[model samples]
Target: MTWTDATLEDLVLLQRGFDITKAEQRDGQIPVISSSGVQSYHNVAKVKGPGVIVGRKGSVGTVYYCETDYWPHDTTLWSKDLKGNDAKFVAYFLRTLNLDRFDTGNSNPTLNRNHIHGQPIKKPDLPTQQRIASILSAYDDLIENNRRRITLLEQAARLLYREWFVHLRFPGHETAKIVDGLPEGWTHCSFAQMAQYLNGFAFKPRHLGENGLPIVKIPELKAGILEKTPRYEGSEVPDKYLLNDGDLIFSWSGTLAVDFWNSGAAYLNQHLFKVTPSVGFSAAFLLVAIRECMPVFMGKAVGATMKHIRRSALDEVMHLLPQGHILADFNHRASELYDQVQLLRAQNQKLTRARDLLLPRLMDGRIPV
Candidate 1:
């Protein structure tokens, strides 16, 4: 089946979603599908779902599909005409269409319902469409499976760390002399005791660029890991903003989770902090422990204003120390798993990059489907 079989005219373009008002956007259980992705709040009535959704306005060519009930936000367009293509198939086909080609509004460059519905997309027959979709979907399945496996591996490592460190269960627990039921050599320590937390320097928004030194920001921290990063040149950063690799980056002001950096040299934003694991301590172990203890910290954190975990507050909290031999053993075991997880994660990242690069070529007739 060639793309010549289907045209944009064959696609039945549904009207754009109704404008979701701000007031109605909150306290609703509906998923607000916008140009970006699923967002909170709702104002518009939902229509045909478990189908393809394309961005008709703000982000002219962006494409999205849903497997469950969803309300399209005003910034996007929904298909009214399935035109024999499986909703999923059409969604993929639309993704291949060059959005820039269909863009009309010079200032906004939007694709309204009329423009998109009338657009030409050469689609294959239904069976062929399904077959192509199946092929592409297999790749997607592998991607999703890799994601789930990574999550499970990470969770298993975390659970083991919690059981040993948080629960204080180890080889020495039974035989070590006990004081108040804790092992004789074991004692409580603060986060400051185990790691020194250093805050980053300030940089105004204007000085920041998109492709320079990787800047770790507060909003980018999640689950004791770094996700999105801001790029800034070293020249742009103040002398104090520099951070070394192996330093655990933390969102000191907003989020409390700490993420370690084993990548190229990077800078930390004002709200970010660096945690230097004390001598003989595993930075990875401390990061996992912080994540495990965040719930307890959140519960005890006090503030009507923005909730945050201050260094002083963190310093006062007690850290349960596992016996030396036990801690070493746990670190050795968990480190092995973590190293493997990291390797798999790196491979998955490479795979995803390769797939994303190939997607456009495959979608367009550039690379034969």
Candidate 2:
């Protein structure tokens, strides 16, 4: 399946996204796009779907294909004149192409319709295009399914954590004494009392390295796991900030989130909060507890420019600290469920990585699909 003598102009490029000014917008039925992608929204006056979209400026080269009707903005370019190219196949091809190579010199890099129109593409015949698209689409479909499965597993874990820990409905609760209407041995304590918390010191962004220990950031602490582990110099991170396996990292700012680090030494920046379970405490259980209490603590935190969570203030936010026997019993019961969720998540990560690694090679015909 070797492609020869292929030119990009052979495949038509459509650059007709309506440019609607903010003031001119009045519940219009279209989405305004600029070279940077979708800039604003308008009511849909017309509809087009199952086409490819690429950013024409600023953040150029990013590509997306849609199967449902979408209004693209003037900043973006929509491929309507596909010229017999499979929309998905074109997206894959665009992704492989370095659109930045065609950038016009400007403060912000940009690519216009003419630039893409003149670019070259090494492509095969229609049947080959369909086969290539089908192979890549299968990988995407599997990756998407894994994403949904991860969400469901996380939701199930969160729900169970809430029911058993937050609601104090653990087994044998009927026999436990009722003290102040709460479960017999349960006692509420502040986050400071239950866990040791610390925030990492500021390190120069340039001090970061690509292959050292992970420097967990706010973005890494989403969906209860670490999605990336971009590294940093061991020196930039103080020993105090360095984390051991089983440490829980919490982001106290926007969209409050948490992640568990079960890997090698890693550190955090000033924006992240690290929590180590107190001696004799269950780290897994505490991870869930922190997630449960985050909403309450985040609501009380104050700042206009950026939300702040004072260590002193966090020390005051309360949580129920159940007595020893009950705590151990709850952990024992929930242990299997948590373990299963973690296993599934690990497998999903592997699948996602495999798919991503295969994408470019498959689309470029380096690997036969």
Estimate the TM-score of every prediction: 0.73, 0.77
Residue-wise lDDT of candidate 1 within 1-369, one digit each (tens)?
Answer: 455644475865566776776666756556788876676755344865667777777767788888766788788877766766677777777776666467778778677666656665565666766766776677677777877886887788798876776676666566668799777877888877887777887777776767777776765444222324567764755666677545677775656666655454667777677777787677767778777777767766656676776668677777788667777776677667667666665566566667667666655656655
- The residue-by-residue lDDT of candidate 2 on 170-247, one tens digit each, is 667668888797877778777777677788668776866676777766755653224345577656456888876556
Model 1 lDDT, residue 177, Cα: 82
Q: Point out where model 1 deviates above 4 Å.
A: 4-9, 12-50, 53-81, 93-135, 222-230, 234-247, 260-265, 299-305
The window of 10 residues in a row where model 2 has the poorest summed lDDT is 220-229
What are the Cα lDDT values of the candidates?
0.69, 0.70
TM value for model 1: 0.73
Q: Any runs in candidate 2 off by more than 4 Å, and if so which? A: 2-4, 7-9, 16-48, 56-60, 71-75, 100-111, 166-168, 173-177, 209-211, 222-247, 261-266, 323-325, 332-335
Top TM-score hit: 2
